[model samples]
Target: METNATTNENLNMYEKAENYTKTSLELIKLKTVSATADVLSTLTSRIAVGAVVAFFTLFLNIGLSLWIGKELGEYYYGFFALAVFYLLVAVILHKTQHKLIKTPIGNMIVSSILKESKN
Candidate 1:
């Protein structure tokens, strides 16, 4: 009878240990997944904002091209000027955006905010 009792206690202890291990692993997995999701969300938001800015810039360029064409009396010449201006804007914006993304603190802050919001 005593031996049986001892065996039962040992089995319970093993079961508890197994359960604890599983829970710890699950928690780690959840944290990892959350962190990855936060990173992706932040990056996606940044890209989306960049796209919106680019779109507005393009629209502005088109409007300016039409305005210039009307004022200068030649649509093609005004369009060429607008094209050069648009190229300049694109280059500057691209360089600025690239530098911003490369900054470590930018991602850290963005990811942290996203993670906090998710919680």
Candidate 2:
């Protein structure tokens, strides 16, 4: 009778461990999904805002170029000046892209995930 009771207790312990493991896995999955959704939503909204700003910048630059061209007596010269300015800007960005862009983006993603986990 004592041996049977001991076996039964061990079986119950095993069942409890199994239940705990399953519950832990489910929680992990839920957290992963929540973090992913948070990051994606944040990125989507930023992209939308960026698109609007891009359009505004495009029109503003075009108008400025035309005005500059009128002042210079040739529209193409305005464009050439703008092109040179942008070329310098592009080179600077390329040189510092890892520091300016990649690190910030990586930190943002990590923070988003940590924020979700905390919640």
Top TM-score prediction, candidate number: 2
Give the C-alpha lDDT of model 2: 0.95
lDDT string for model 2 (9-38, tens) is: 999999999999999999999999999999
TM-score of each candidate? 0.59, 0.94
Per-residue C-alpha lDDT of model 1 across residues 61-112, encoded as one tens digit per residue? 7788888988899877779997787799888878887576557667686668
Top of the candidates by lDDT: 2
The weakest ten consecutive residues by lDDT in model 2 span 76-85
| Native-referenced Cα lDDT, model 1 | 0.82
Off by over 4 Å in 2: none
Q: Given candidate 2, what's the lDDT at residue 87? A: 98
Off-target runs (Cα >4 Å) in candidate 1 are 1-7, 33-55, 93-98, 104-110, 113-119
